[model samples]
Target chain A: MTVRDPKQWRLLETGLRRAAENFAIDRALLESHQAGTSPHTLRFLRFHPSALLGFHQNVEQELNLDYIRAHDIDIQRRLTGGGAIYFAPEHLGWELFLDKAVLGTADMTVIARRICEAAAAGLSSLGVDARFRPRNDIEVDGRKISGTGGAFDGDSILYQGTVLVAFDVERMLRVLRIPAEKLSDKAIASAGERVVSLQGLLGSPPALDTVRQALATAFGQAFGALFETESQLNPAELPLYEDALAEIDCNDWIYQRNRPETEAPMREAIHRCRGGTLRCGVVLDEPRQRLNQVWITGDFFAAPRRLVVDLESALRNTALVDLERNVGRFFDGYPVQMMMLGPDDFAAAIRSAVASVPEPVDG
Target chain B: MQACNGCEFIGTLYYDPEFQIWVRREQNGSLTVGMTDISQTVAGKILHVRVRRPGTRRPAGKPVATVESGKWAGPVPNYFDCVIIEGNPAVLADPPLLNADPYGAWISRVEPTLGADLALADFLTGETAFAGYCERVRNEGIQCERRTG
Candidate 1:
């Protein structure tokens, strides 16, 4: 397919590239467009096995470098927000390069939802139940089918995400900090509950072409435009890509500019409750003097699985004293179900952990 | 709020004569810095503001913080050495605040170990900052909060 007009959004498929190259191309296109040298684009890319951290994330805490190196997985940091994600050749990646004028809003969170909802409509057309989950994720039922993030400049924008046509939870555990690291049979099951894949949904991975076509169609409708396939980067973007790739592909580009990972110890608190054993992994955000990430797991049954995921995300990165307020606020509006599990139980577990260091006092 | 000499930079900016630099915030005798209004118009609608952690280290004349919007990402280039002060767990929570109050709701602040008062003096303000702001406003398509000179 050939693009005849610069205004017409172009669609291109860049076969699997290392994380750096793919991300560098992202930088190049966004930069070129910001400089008023490039056009709106839709790109389909695939990643060689890699674990990616968010732009502001600490590498040490987010990834399992040993597993990444031994498995020959590429590691890179994203230019967006949210948590870390594990990407590989098996998952299909999609990105939209457009001007913010198309969306009529400057808010990233709102932009994320509009794009996800449109993609959900496209996914729904493919006979799969897909919907946009708040704060920037697309899911089938309550399980995540797509995770996304975005970057913007001047008027040009790049919002991207991956759909798990095929994925491995066990491999992800090796690359990420799982809620439970016991590595026992129980650990694997626990990890499975937290993540789901398309293969598990369809009994086999969807073909690559089918996934791309669906995404392209989704994006086309989302933007109310037509997509004509192309084979290369825009000429204006080539020079920029080269420059960006040079910086990002090397160690200094990757690690030289980074801060020492925020090494908040993974402290655990076992609270004996009549209902069940509640185990919490509590971490502190030293900079904010707050409770960063918290995981509550152990023979716990919660209804509306999204509630658990939402609760975890709510408390995932919160301040210590702010814990009770956050939990209470989340329950105040969020529809969650745990017959015996109360907000106080949640607050108690977090309080027990915050009591240890007492923050600024000790350190 | 404690008395501090800081000026607001709207879509287009003006620098105060009394203060050479637009102090983002004053903390423990340190200055937090960021771009003025004239900067954001050129930058575009901020999609995401990614700042280093509070304890994150930095050298002067470095890209300490990064802001992303409309698919483009650029460093919030700084003119002084700094370290992020404790507050705001993640930039994602209130990224727009960077634009709403770029100087007040700063991206990050330097703890001012090496250069404090000296660097602040050299920072832009008055007719000089206003001139710089106008150039940015025109070069990068943007409207001003008030009619500029």
Candidate 2:
């Protein structure tokens, strides 16, 4: 197999655009580039204050749509699978429009990682010591500097990411209905742990141009390809972009295609004892009949106090039936000193909490 | 390797996809599928892979393999209803084998009871695979440099 030279790829900076327009361009360019008509290209784009959810995400569960509407922030759905996100002017978006052939495979997921880690390398080039976090995040010391995802068809794929040159965690707290995210300082602190942006870490956000250059340079190095700056959209892409934007820009395009939010209940169950009151809120993936997320919070006294955090991580996206087994399995391995807190007690708290809810079955 | 038409593998593999693990079926009466290079590209140096065991009936479209990347759970599914014929427990215990040699490692052995599906066709190669890819790109909204292969 032969690889394309660096000079073969192109780069474009498509300034601020609406979410639909951006997504449509993703569709158009990925299709064209993979068809052999467009060059393997990297595009730098920006969004005007939006709260977007991954394709598989539920709106009500992932976002506070009311808050977005009131704030005049755009609400859009990304054509990728991952968590929902809040993007604003403070963030920069970067995407790759390339063929699977260039990456050398037809696997969509693999393409995302290749691009993300390369971007992570670019961040590293920027002296951020950034690293790729599995599934879909680039983090700096465990706090994400960028979050990415993609949509693909055949060989053409669109892998896009949000570079947090700057971020607004407070607005994110309001835009996404992350349960108890704003309830307290600790809760907000927890939210901060899960996300990070440039301004928050560096005191000042770098220029957008600098970040884009780092990314392009990093990707070029990763692929051993040269990137020539260009500002051109191929003819093959216009019609597809138009059609996609038309459908994507409208509410009908975004909503009414998905199952109801009630299918994924944000059910909560709590248990209290001397150790601490454990509050377990679960978002069920009804189709798979599993716990999409398990949030365990409590006023408990446990050493390596990140035990709850680890436990939450251990049980993430687990099937409900596997919940108890996972919890027991977790305790058996993790050596933690919990005063007045037993393994079974913690498991029982979560199990009973799940049972208490007559969760709405998938209709 | 090119037995079933233009079926092919691209350059150096990378682990860089979202949940970058998957199962593909080949007609050798056994599946010849594994993770793509790009999947490993972004996995940030995969620590391990946990493929499903042979004789384990993984229903169509469900995870038949579980790979761990950066301590996050990544699921790889058999695109069709499958029965594992051969899988490596050795690699399962060490996971990086999938990243080190994705195509050579061949994650699992499953015979798609329904044969290979068309949806799986795009990922796999047949005669004219490259041309088909080119067609896909032509439809996308991106400008390109000319190609002559």
Q: Residue by residue across B82-131, what tens digits does model 1's lDDT show?
A: 67664444345556555565555655556765656665555555456655
Local accuracy of candidate 1 as per-residue lDDT tens digits, A1-363: 222244477788899989998999888877776666766778889999888877656666666666778899888877655567899789888888776667765545567788889878866766778888876778887888888877655446788888888877788777875434434577677657666667877788778888788877877776777767787887888998998888888766556334333446556676666566676667665555556577767766667877766787766555565678888988999776676778888788777765554322111
The 10-residue segment of model 2 chain A with minimum total lDDT is A354-363
Tell me the TM-score that candidate 2 gets on chain A alone.
0.85
The local lDDT score (0 to 100) that residue A73 gets in candidate 1 is: 87
Error of 1 at B57 (Å): 17
TM-score of chain A of each: 0.91, 0.85
Q: Write the per-residue lDDT of candidate 2 for residues A200-260, one digit (tens) a residue.
A: 7777888888888889889988887887787757677788789888878988757633556
Q: What is the C-alpha lDDT of each candidate?
A: 0.66, 0.65
